[model samples]
Target: MFNNWSELLPTIQKAFGALGKSNPKMVKAYMALGEAAAENEVLDAKTRELISIAVAITTRCDGCIAAHTDAAIKAGASREEVAATLATAISLNAGAAYIYSLRTLEAYDSLKG
Candidate 1:
């Protein structure tokens, strides 16, 4: 029934927190990687936040979406940029799902033949 991530907070929160606890060391390492990326002068803070926003949207992560959206704004990303990043995310999600659906249909066709 939930068509968008705005409607999936509870599910996202449970799974996201579980992942952080499931492997603290790994999660720390991943956080370090994110910090490294954020510190990269070539990328700029705004770009880093934008990337985070893109990742959050693609993954349908409510907590991440909220965090990164805030970070993006603080890093000077315009509202338009944030909206565009979400749109891009939606397009990529659709493409990925379509690919899998097509593969399933192809498999079904093979079985029918």
Candidate 2:
């Protein structure tokens, strides 16, 4: 898993490199958000990491998943905790998708009738 960023495929490396160079102000803003979030007494680091990983997984952002997973581990989250967060994300996402499907089918059913 991203064992060698430097040795990554050229296209991937370029893409990531471009992302790193793209937006200084936005990057700073995100950094500020992270800093403020960390300072929130009600949200411990592990909690933050769990939420971050859940969002990353739901949003299908591989880079984010990697970054947040590492952060979670560093913040003293066990593997089980990270796995549980992912499971919760998957479950909730599935429920949301199913609800949308049901809504769409209901709309079509009404139109058909």
Candidate 3:
């Protein structure tokens, strides 16, 4: 794990606070966007956080993974759920690599020919 989430979230928040000091309106807007996106109409908070975790993994965003993992637990995601979400992320990443390798093979064949 790249971050100890318990410690990292506060550090991230402090960094954001510094950014807010520099540009208050933009920071406010960004915070508001987060709130709007997290509204639980179509998806519950737990589901949203789970999806965020998966996206964080795919994007290789350590901060996002730490934050959303915390949020997912707070939103009532079980250990089983977390494991399943990670499994899905792993499968999707591998599948993407597999598909992209086909393109690599095609390029190699063209070059060889």
Candidate 4:
């Protein structure tokens, strides 16, 4: 496992709490943004958490993955659901590279032109 997920969350929580104490407004704004995003009713809590986990994996945010994975499991996400979402995350990461490669080609052609 890449992370000791058991202790990672608590350690991250402490680090974030320290940051929040040092910069209250920034932390508050971040929390508010999360709340605002959750206000949208299109996705249920479980789905939102699943999406969050996917984003965390693709973005390489271990803290986010640990937090959101715990949240997802608590939200009643099944093992199958998590597995499928992980696969989606992997595909998205690959797709991003594919798209960037296309953009690289385009940039070269445009520069040559």
Candidate 5:
């Protein structure tokens, strides 16, 4: 982990506080967006937060991982569920890298020929 997940929420609050001091309107907008997306009723909180955690991992966003992991737990996700989400993220990230390497190989082959 990029940071202690336990400290995630507080750290975010602190960071956002600093950002808000500098750009209050932008911070307000961001917070509003988060609230809107999260409060949507189609998916339950647990599932939405679990998906957020997976996307955070896939995107390699440290802040997102920490925040979403905390949120996922709060939303009633089990440790096993988090593990499964992370495993899926890992698999997809690795698969994407492997597939993209084909383009690298193709470039090398073209240069050689």
Candidate 6:
């Protein structure tokens, strides 16, 4: 019931450590993928973290939201920037719902026909 977002980071790290102990190879591969993504030269860390935040929101991943928000701040993202990124996510989520509604209506039409 703790609403402390920052505190969630350490908890996630501990869980990840325990998971790594259980399945080392999968964890190692995941870490390597993260490293490879981090090493990409074009976007820079701050932008990536912002994108990660948007993705986490769309995917409804609380752990990702906590970690990426922290990473974004550490990468020098301002509050304004994070808010802007969230706005984009909101727009995209709404758009996705709109598109799916159209598809659902289509299905209804086809079924009725």
Q: Report the alpha-carbon TM-score of model 6 versus the true structure.
A: 0.92
lDDT per residue, candidate 3, 24-107, as tens digits?
A: 999999889878987656888999999999999999987888889999999999999999999999999999999999999999
For model 6, residues 1-113, the per-residue Cα lDDT tens digits are 64578678899999999999999999999999879988867899999999999999999999999999999999999999999999999999999999999999999999999
By TM-score, the candidates rank as 6, 4, 3, 5, 2, 1
Candidate 1 lowest-lDDT run of ten = 1-10
- Cα lDDT tens digits, model 2, 1-113, are 64552344454546756766897677678678989988857989889999999999889876677677777888999999988998999999999899999999999999999
lDDT of 2 at 33: 93
Per-residue lDDT of model 5, residues 1-113, tens digit only = 55676777788869879999999999899889878986768888898888899899888887888788878888899999999988988999999999889989999999999
Regions of model 2 farther than 4 Å from truth: 1-22, 110-113
Question: Which ranking of candidates, highest lDDT first?
Answer: 4, 6, 3, 5, 2, 1
Residue 19 lDDT in model 1?
Answer: 93
Worst 10 residues of 2 by lDDT: 2-11
| Superior candidate under lDDT, 3 versus 6 | 6
Candidate 6, residue 112: the lDDT equals 100
**Ten-residue region with minimum lDDT total, candidate 6:** 1-10
lDDT of each: 0.81, 0.82, 0.91, 0.95, 0.86, 0.94
Model 5 RMSD in Å is 2.3
Q: What pairs collide in candidate 2? A: none
* Per-model TM against the reference: 0.69, 0.75, 0.83, 0.92, 0.81, 0.92
Model 3 / residue 107 / CA error / Å:
3.4
lDDT-superior candidate, 1 or 2 = 2
TM-score of predicted structure 1: 0.69
Q: Which stretches of candidate 4 lie over 4 Å from their true place?
A: none
Alpha-carbon lDDT of model 1: 0.81
For residues 1-113, what per-residue lDDT tens digits would candidate 1 score against the true structure? 43354545556667767998999888789779977876758988888788888888788776787777767888999999888887888898899999999999999999999
Error of 6 at 108 (Å): 1.7
